[model samples]
Target: MKSPSVVMLRRNLKHIARNPTSVFNAVLMPVIVMLMFVYMIGDAFNVGVNYVDYATPGLLLLAVCYGLGSVAVSVNSDMTKGVINRFKVMDVPRSAVLTGHVVASVLTNLIAVAAIIGVAFALGFNPSASFMQWLEVIGIVVLLGFATGWLTVALGLFAKTPETAGMAAIPLIMLPFFSSAIVPADKMGPGLREFAKYQPFTPIIETLRGLLAGAPAASDVLQALAWLVGIVVVGYLWAFASFTKRA
Candidate 1:
């Protein structure tokens, strides 16, 4: 017999499989952005390297951010539709309910990441990372997706409706734009530059850029890990608290 969380994972996966819009938003949107950057506007930006190489890491992060809305909406749907309540009545382990969504989300986001990477390659995005560095890149992306999955789950739980839950994730989607994703933070004006530098996503994006360049900074790696840990901790606690109260 499968564990309840595994069963829930399968259930959520089926839901995602049936939702074409979710898949498109999660996967294709980032690819489209990459195409736009690499082909259209790439010439205007001078990042001291090929724009494809410089921008792919940030686009990868964008893929992760774009995928968060579906997770939030899915969780909000369950909450608003009483699926969570039904699970409670059936004696389902409460943790399994949220775990299913989080795991399914992480798995799906990874597929989105892979698709973006493929598209990046087709557009001439190149990285100098060795085999181990590639693995590290994968690990960081997974950690980011996992951490943000819980955050979206929490958002879903807090939202009164699925639409609102989707809206709540807009900040997340927009956050990458404010970071060093498309351009270096130094290019920004005074206040915005400092904000971009200290924000959570910048370190993560920088770490990814460094990893792809084969020289990840220790500070960036550590800061990214710290942010991931903090997000997971806060999101986990808030999700369970909301679940307990709402369900």
Candidate 2:
């Protein structure tokens, strides 16, 4: 018998392969946004750092946003089309269905990251991190994307319609921007700066920046992981509650 996770992974890959256009959006939109930020802000702002370098981490986080948004839409479409109802009747493992979608989201985001890296290079960004640092960056992206997928899945399950899913997603999607994504938290005004410093996103963005800048990992990594853990726990609970209600 196939391992449950492996079975789900294969099933997700097959489904994703059938609709390459959705896959293409997962790859292209983030790259375009990254390019826009790199060019528009690369020279326009004097942030006292190389612009592409400054923007890379933000772009990476933006990739997470793109992936999560797409996941919500896809999951909502599945639910709305009665496909989820069919799955429930077919006796598929509930965890497997969720994991399959999460795995697919990770794979799709990885593709978007690769494309963004290429664009970063063309825009003259240079990474100074060692091999291990590079691995750490990838690790952060993977975990972050997975956590965001869980959140998106929760939103998809709870929302009454696909349109509602999009509306519900706005705040979470806009979070990185108000955090350390584009500019340092300290650089913003007093009120906004205070808010940014305490939020979950700051630590994650800070960790990414430290890694990219070849600095020591901040103590904030622990905080970021704590936040990820808490969100994942609550997100899964919501997802399970919604799944049960609708099942």
Candidate 3:
């Protein structure tokens, strides 16, 4: 017999496959932003390298954020529609349902990330990382996605409706803008620069930027991992607590 999580994973994947609009919505905004940055406004800013190269990693983070909104919406849908209650009555593990959503989210968002990268390449984004560095990039991206998946799941469970859950995710989507994603932190004004420097996304983006440039700093990588681990732990606990309370 297939595991409950596996079964639920298939169910979620099928739903996503049928509703192509979700995927399209997730990918569209990030692509437009990348194009705007690379074409209309890129030359205006100087990051010392090709603007495309400096911006791709940050855009990739943006794509991940957009994709997570769907995860929150999907989880909220399951909660509101009584699907989870049905699973509980059938003796399914509650964890399986959340697990399924998180895994499916990571898988779908990865495809979205790949699509964003492809668009970046078309816009002259170039990564100088070695094969090993590329693997590290993939690892970090996956880790970040998984951690945020649980966080979104918790948000979905806590929300009164899907729209509310999506709204809750808006802060996450906007967070990259405050980070060193599009422009360097030093280029920003006083207060904004300090916030951008210390925020969670800054270290993650910096690590990614360094990796793509083939010179990742140990400090940045460690900070990124610490942030990911903390998110995963907190998100997991919060999600289950919310599930127990709500379900």
Highest TM-score: which candidate? Answer: 1
Off by over 4 Å in 2: 1-11, 14-21
Clashes of each: 0, 0, 0
lDDT of 1 by residue, 1-247 (tens): 8999999999999999999999888888898998998899989998999998999999999999898899999999999998988898988998999999999888888888999889888888789999999999999999998899999999999999999999999999999999999999999999999999999999999999999999999999999999999999999999999998898
Q: Which candidate leads in lDDT?
A: 1
lDDT of each: 0.93, 0.79, 0.89
In candidate 1, list every pair of residues with a backbone clash. none
After best superposition, candidate 2 residue 75: deviation in angstroms?
Answer: 1.8
Model 2, clash count? 0
TM-scores of the models, in the order given: 0.98, 0.90, 0.96
How does candidate 1 score on lDDT? 0.93
lDDT of 2 at 45: 60
lDDT of 3 at 210: 94
lDDT: which is higher, 1 or 2?
1
Question: What is the total number of backbone clashes in candidate 3?
Answer: 0
Q: What is candidate 1's CA lDDT for residue 61? A: 94
lDDT winner, 1 or 3: 1
Q: Which sequence of candidate numbers ranks them by TM-score, best first?
A: 1, 3, 2
lDDT at residue 39 of model 1 (Cα atoms): 92
